[model samples]
Target: MIRVVVADDQALIRTGFITILDSQDDLEVVGEAGDGKSAVEVAQRLRPDVIVMDVRMPVMDGIEATRRLAGAGVPDPLKVLVVTTFNLDEYVYEALRAGAAGFLLKDASPQQLIAGVRTVARGESLLAPEVTRRLIGRYAARLRPADPAVTAESALTPRELEVLRLIAAGQSNAEIAATLVIGAETVKTYVSRILTKLNLRDRVQAVVYAYRTGLVSPND
Candidate 1:
């Protein structure tokens, strides 16, 4: 089963997510927290597979909580899914930078929510390429990348670079296979190599790395 922890200041919202997630045979609500601080605490204790976090909460916001749970220095980071009633680009950008596996609008359908959790649990990112690009276009200027000089050319083979570009473009493994005239497993291998070379945790981080390093730009 995929263990999930729900964190929201609103009782109704928290309960609603718990109900929706728990009804799935493959999913279970391991814990719930009413604020960001509590969310962090519960996550540390439960070590859930996915965390459904609210962006704005008292004591700490979801962004900071995500950083604490899944940030750069974390040894065993948990996957986080930032959920909000608002679609503020800044929130989405910060959440991703803070190591969230994806962003979900609270009004997203119940099925979407379930899918988001499953996506994150399976170690896949939930953010679409277009959404990631748009959010980065709006907020990337506010944050400095850890390394501005890093380039895929220096580290990856030409074919691997192409695969990274397709991933940054938001193409799925199947789509990338079709585009590159390769097998799906070959595309997966390229993706794995790209991640290893980049020292990225997952495709979501790879997407962020691509944008931050100008491998794929906002205009592209």
Candidate 2:
């Protein structure tokens, strides 16, 4: 079972989430907190696999709580998925920077909420929202491009680069194979190589790096 702890300033919201999550056979609501301070404490005590975090808590807030939890090195650190009603928030990006697994709108469908938990619990990030992906592209434009000099010219062969570009365009491996007229397994191989060379955690990070490195432009 995936252990979950909900942290939100609203008592009703916490109760609502706990009820929703506990309904799932595969998930258990181990604890709940009305503030970030108690959140950190309960999470450390229960060692939940996932934390349904809310951004605007009474103290510390979600971003700081995530940073502190990660930095303090909780023995079995929880994967925080920020749940908020607002789609656009100043704190969202900072929360991600502080190592939140992902963010979800509070009104997300039950399937999406459950999927968010499973994705983070499995050590994978949820797919980047299209708006958030574009946000990252704009964020990348602020920095000078990475050294533009790569040692291994053949590290990602021309074909592999094509595959990487498709991934940056948000194409799944199966989708890329269909578009490129290649086998899915071959596409997966190319993806693995791209990640190995780039040292990214997952495809979402790869897409970010692709834009940052100019491998794929914002228009592309």
Candidate 3:
């Protein structure tokens, strides 16, 4: 089963999420928290597979909590899926930068929410194409380039670099294969190699890395 912890300041929303998630045979709501601090504590103690986190909370916010659990230097980082009713660009970008595996609007369908949990549990991100482009575009415009020493550009072959750019552009494996006129399995191999070379945890980080390196611009 996929263990989940729901963290939201609002009781109704929190309970509602629990109901929807627990109804699934493959999912279980193991814990709930009304604030970010407790959320972190519950997560650390329970070690749930995925956390469904809300942005605004008492004491600490979801962004900081996510950073604590999944940020750059942390070992054995937990997977976080940030959910909010607000469409604020800064919130989305900050949550991603803080190492959230995915982002979802609270207004998302129940199916979408459940699918998102499964996706994150399987080590995949859930960035909506349009929202991802806009948020990453803003991030690229505001933040400085990532450190030169950490860049793995030279580690990738030209084909791998092209695949990375397409990934940063939000293309899926099948789409990339179709675009490149290659087999889907070959595309998957390239993706795996790219992640290995870049040392990215997942495609979400790959997107951020691409933007941070200025390898793919917002307009691209």
The top-ranked prediction according to lDDT is 3
lDDT (CA) for every model shown? 0.86, 0.74, 0.89
Number of the predicted model whose TM-score against the real structure is largest: 3
When summed lDDT is taken over every stretch of 10 residues in candidate 2, the lowest stretch is 145-154
Per residue, candidate 1 scores C-alpha lDDT tens digits across 10-108 of: 999899999999999999999999999999999999999999999999999999999999999999899999996545667877788899988888788
Candidate 2, overall lDDT?
0.74
Please count the clashing residue pairs in each candidate, in the order shown.
Answer: 0, 0, 0
Clash list (residue pairs), candidate 1: none
Models sorted by lDDT, best on top: 3, 1, 2
lDDT of 2 by residue, 105-213 (tens): 7778878888888888787666545545545455555556555345224567888788878877767677789999989899888888877886655665566567667
Error of 3 at 58 (Å): 2.2
Candidate 3 regions off by >4 Å?
Answer: 148-152
Better of 2 and 3 by TM-score: 3
| Candidate 1 Cα RMSD (Å) | 2.0
